[model samples]
Target chain A: QQQVKQSPQSLIVQKGGISIINCAYENTAFDYFPWYQQFPGKGPALLIAIRPDVSEKKEGRFTISFNKSAKQFSLHIMDSQPGDSATYFCAASMEASYDKVIFGPGTSLSVIP
Target chain B: DAGITQSPRHKVTETGTPVTLRCHQTENHRYMYWYRQDPGHGLRLIHYSYGVKDTDKGEVSDGYSVSRSKTEDFLLTLESATSSQTSVYFCAISRVTRGEQYFGPGTRLTVT
Candidate 1:
């Protein structure tokens, strides 16, 4: 079973537009949610993370809006740029374990210039 | 990015052969993980080590085996390679308490 489910296997957005990707989970035990970005031929890098206590977290043009009760979360990249084109993955983890993280399938986002 | 390196960044082998991939960490983190990334699937954990000589299997460990003799190195081995095992493998290290795992560049393995 996919503990965390992500939608829109692929997406395309023009530059300066708002790009959105959504994710939902079935495990309420997950307390930490993180988004990772990966480029071709490279490993994934941490983009942003949010805790259950906060409804939304933003860093620069990237934002993560989390809904604890809904067991859902979404990633928003504002003013999207071509450089932002990459595969984005959403992951969930609970502190109860010693850092065991479960990742979502991933969303391929393409930002047009 | 943490100081993590995956040896033999790329490898190709025939079916029924044995292949081993190594993950080394300079960060000296207590926890290390081995994961596989495929085209349509997210990264799936093959195995993980909490400390030297202490390891555990992850969700997908059927065709793989792992070992950690020291805190700095973790190894994943495929007893008998198969075409289905061809994929990109990644290693990550982290401090258990922090829950922030750092990943390595990754290794591309092909089993023909």
Candidate 2:
């Protein structure tokens, strides 16, 4: 069973446009949600993260909007740049599980100039 | 960037052979994880260790085994490599269970 699910296996946006990727989870126990970005042939790096205590978090042009009640979260990139094109993964974890994360399928984003 | 390194960055092996990938970290993190990345499937946990000589299976532990005998070293072994086991393997570490994880560059394995 895929406890965490993500939509739009792929996406494309023009430079300076907004890019969005959505994710959902069925496990209510999940309390920690994080997003990771990966470039070709490299490891995925932490882009941003959010806890259930907050409805939204912003870091630079990256923003994570979380809806705990809806069991969903989305990543919004303002002013998307060609360099921002890469794969994004959304993950969820809880303290009960020792914080072992369950990652979503992932979304491939392409920013064209 | 996390002082994590994976050895044998690329390998080609025959089916039914045995293979091992190593993950080494210098951050002295308390938790280490082994994950395999495949097309369409994303990254799936194979195993994880919280301390030396202590390890646990993850969702896809079949056909694989792991050992963590030192604070900086974690090993993933394929008892018998299979074609399906060919994928990019990644190692991740975190200072605490709930903290952000730092991932290794990844190792790509191909089985014939």
Candidate 3:
């Protein structure tokens, strides 16, 4: 069973446009939600993260909007650039499980100039 | 870069053969993890260690074994290679269980 589910297996956006990817989790025990970005032939890197306590968190052009009650979270990239093209993964983990994260399949994003 | 390195970045072996991958870290982190990434499957944890000589199985641990005898090194071994085990393996380190995890470049393994 995929505990975490992500929408839009892939996405394409134009430069200067907004790019969004959504994710949802079935386990209410999840407390920490994080997003990772990966470039070709490299490992995934931490992009942004949020906790259930906060409804939203923003850093630079990346923002994570989380809804605890809905068990959903979304990532928004403002003014998407061609350089932003990469794969994004959303993950969830609870403190009790030693922070063993469960990740969504992934969303491949492409920003065209 | 968290000072993590994965040896044998690429490997190819035949079925029934044994394969081992190495992950080394200089960050002195207390936690280390091994994960496998595949298309449409995201990343699945194979094993993790919280301290030297302490390890735990992850969601997908079948046919896999791990060891952490030293703080700077963690190893993942495939008892007997199988085609189903082919995938990109990644090692991650964190200062604490809930802290941010830093990932190594990755090792692409192929079992024929």
- What are the per-model numbers of colliding residue pairs? 0, 0, 0
Model 3 chain A poorest 10 in a row by lDDT: A92-101
Per-residue CA lDDT of model 2 for A90-113, tens digit only, reads 998885664369898999999999
How far off is residue A60 in model 3, in Å? 0.7
RMSD of each: 1.2, 1.1, 1.1
TM-score of 3: 0.97
Compared with the real two-chain complex, what DockQ does model 1 have? Answer: 0.64
**Residue-wise C-alpha lDDT for candidate 3, range B1-112, written one tens digit per residue:** 7999999999999999999999999978888999999999999999999899999999999999999999999999999999999999999997654536789999999999
Q: DockQ numbers for every candidate?
A: 0.64, 0.64, 0.67
Docking class of 2: medium
lDDT of each: 0.90, 0.91, 0.92
lDDT minimum window of 10 residues, candidate 1 chain A: A93-102
TM-score of chain B of 3: 0.97
Better of 2 and 3 by lDDT: 3
